[model samples]
Target: MDPSRTLVLNTIIKEKAVFTLFQPIYDLAKRQILGFEALSRGMSGSLLESPDKLFAIASKQERLSELEIICREAAIKQFVSLNLPGKLFLNVSPKALLDPSHPKGETRHLTEVYGLDPKRVVIEVTEQDKVDDANLLLTTITHYRELGFQIAIDDLGAGYSGLRKWSELCPDYVKVDRYFIDHCDQSVVKREFLKSIIELAKATSTQVIAEGIERMEELKLIEQLGIVNAQGFLLAKPTRKPPTELALLKSLHSEVRSSVNQFEQSMAIGWLAKEANAIHECTQCIDAHRLFEQDRKLTSLAVVNDAREPVGLLHRDQLTEVFAAPYGHALFDKKSVIKLMDKQPLVVDEQQELDTVSKQITDHEFDIRRHIIITRDGRYLGLAPLRDILKHITEEKIRHAQHANPLTMLPGNVAINEAIEQRLRSHHDFSLAYIDLNHFKQFNDLYGYASGDSVIKLLAEVTVDVCAQSSSFVGHIGGDDFMVVFDNNDAEVLCHEIITQFELKSKAFFTPEHVSAGGYWATNREGQKQFVPLLTLSIGLVRPDLQHCINSHQVAALATDAKKEAKRYRNSYLFVCNRRKPTVSTVRLENAG
Candidate 1:
């Protein structure tokens, strides 16, 4: 990314320079070797072997021909040496492919010398050098595809116009960028973004692979997000020898499914559950008083109507008058619940929006004050005394609030990841959700610098406050968005809760004028009615099994991958679940070096 590195890439391109360094890509589920992505490192020191610098240089300079040839040759040479049944992803400059001379005769030469299958030799049009002419790039890529070479769009999510570029190029494979993977579990915002990417890849029918997975946490996050192809140190460091074990592959596949189960349990969280007919009804005032004795005073009962449908609520005080008049136990027990029931009680579920809870508390409508519990099916199951549930939720809130976002107080990326990690580590089944906001720049441009900060803080506070009682965690990764951890096992209910809360709270961020205008209205530094930008969120959720995981780091990685899918899927959300770990059950995976 520095000027000097750019110079090196430029020099390498002009000079026909390329050196081959191998990075291992593995199949954790199959425990088989996929192959390597041949990387190009320049000769110059200080700037040499630096991927960022090389990319910047290529983008800045127009001389991409020399670089392309070198990269192809290097990949071919390595592929020939291995002579294995795997693909070699060679990074090629899109600019160079525009010229007829570049790919001509190159196909036969690569196969003849390197023994690589034309179909397996993937030409990755990397983001290092973007496509200036969409038509030209597509035509050039099509030409190579005709020659039996596979096409890949590399580092798509990491760039400014990755989606646009992908649309134009239509590559067979998409490699997500690394920055999004880093610290993914902690920042819900990012997980949302990454999950979008995965969905997009699926829709396009393009295989998605993640690169630069350094830590175990990151890998677990990615796997849980439903990504099957992985390349990172957590799987295995790049080396001369290929992987020879099958256990790795099986482990990888299993871990994905198990993680999902944990998330479901967390979402359906309950200390106790039972049938509606388990309790007796009160008829007399004396009977009500007896039911209210000592520790029993706070019980709230579910009252059903004649047809066995739950129609109202029942509490001890409502029947106190009958209890004082006292009758036989038979009279009291046989009485219908309707007489003592408080008809309009608040009903909620395992997946109720945390913010809805917040709103009810804020309004302080005493009759509606009692919290009712519903099954995953939204059926009335039991009642939650506000005092106790709130006490527990308050503790979670204190913990959640204690960890503030670095840029905004909503909650930092670290806190988000930690909550997910804690849940996954406990192996009780939970989800790590990633939330990322899309197209935030226009807001900054119109509202100026000061207002942008307000937008970010507003998002953080709202997301955090909304998830207060369900023990759902909210974390702000950075910049414009936030994340939420929904632990319910019922996928439908969990997704519903988040979407409902986000839609409602988002309204508060916009002004009345902006809301009516069909877009938002923000003042510029000079104070103008700048058009409000499109506001959307991408979400990815992953659940990793702790018992099978190597360590916390692995779970963190899985969370990050889920985030990548969020971004790729067009500002939407994705869910990835793991059944088991893909590698050995070591507590931690250490760097090979």
Candidate 2:
């Protein structure tokens, strides 16, 4: 290090010439600003103007312990001044903690100066170098934790000896570096590494945060991987004064939550019936008989424990036959119903997926328990008979098949409507692209019906392939029209790719003579012969602003309008409606391959 630079660093530390800025960290699941990380900054145009340079110069001069203490004091005072609602993430060095005058009990005392609790402070230890004394560091961390402070290990994968630090210290939170998060969606190795880290963190009872999420795609992928907390510039930038109200935090959280829910629902089973229609285990046989006689539909009753957990099931027919026998009522008129209950009954969890649960029930041929008890978390929720489960499963299969397009076998209007409602109900921003092939009728007329079916099938194949990699839902809306519900913000880019693929494959649909001619001659609707151009696509895009549109119908109406406008032009086009307003942007896709 230079002598002059060392002098400047010492002068700054001695005078406490530094201030702190805060960057917000968001909670993806709760959809709120969880806390702000304190960042240190020096006076502009000085040797230590930026955090990187400041820390670098201090570490070189062997005065980093002094510099960190000064910076922390200023940060704490300012944070108290602002009266921030969430936890404060304060950076600390293991060497600084071991300083003779570091004041082990001062953290609790300092926070109490402005009516602050030490519990709200999270001491984030950054592992720049290996700790010389791991036992001392662990003891110091435990001391702070006992005073109601939290511990976090920053830049886990980017630093040296981070795994050892994590294993020994066992911080409450582990922050994954941006190296793993940057373009995570595109890299299989990064995704797998992050998933394993998350699993390890879960096993250790530690929460993981994906740091440095600057792109929408990165944020979407990280959230999909189930990391519930994150800090990044895409969500919010660091500011001198952190925001008290989390307006942007709420918005991005809704987007992440909606996308995750929609993706999970694509493979979800239909809602199952819970524990309803249950009878107490202590009811007498005569009283149970009277209740059954009152309602003919009550063919069976589930006997539950004091905690409302299912114990057994009682078949009405068997019990009634016993009472109907001569001198049978006198023999067991006052006996408890528990004596007659079926001790071993079919008990299934309510959350079991439709297919798996159905298979379990039908696996045994001789067992004829009339009703299957549905439970939630080991507690009786309701009763579902074999009849109800079979009916529901059958209806779901029939619904799927009936709503599928005959030619492409993709979801049709019925399934499309349900998917739209599901997305809208999640209350997140998403795009619904209404895709239609232009002059499809002309192609069908020029070629044969079989040729037309091939084109439809081709469109379906491309749409499915594009959507298969994403959390998007694709449906064939009959004829040459289709629908796509996008989970990511790359709707336009995906559309362009789809159009390019379709155009490349368009030549194969035409004969060489017709291909050279560009198109075929066809009679117009006015009964006049005119030359029509080759097949093109018209896509109407509508992304409902959840703040304005309350239902899927409103979004569909806007998209339909955009579709009409897109179809006006002869070339392939993408039209997007801004919102409830009529303003739209039309992208022409002429000469696109």
Estimate TM-scores for all models. 0.40, 0.60
lDDT of each: 0.60, 0.76
Tens digits of per-residue lDDT, candidate 2, 160-243, equal: 888888888888888898899998999999988888887677556677888899988888777666675788888777888988
Cα deviation of 135, candidate 2, in Å: 1.5
lDDT of 1 by residue, 1-593 (tens): 46666666666766756666666677542345666777666663645667565555664565456566776786687667766456787877666777555657675576767666687788887785655677777777787888888888888676667888888767778888877887787879878777788667656656678887877777767755655467766666654444534354455434433332333333222332334431333343344445557446455666554332345566765565555465634455555665556544544444443444444444433443465544433344555656655565566667667767556656565565566666665655655565666556765665577766766666666555555434455667666645566665544345555556655666565667765765765676586866654556665566666676545556555555565666666444555545335233222212100
Clashing pairs in 2: 274-381, 274-382, 275-381, 275-382, 276-382
Give me the runs in candidate 1 sitting further than 4 Å from their true place: 1-18, 43-63, 99-103, 239-593
lDDT score, residue 437, model 1?
62
Off by over 4 Å in 2: 245-248, 253-398, 406-409, 413-438, 441-477, 481-532, 537-593
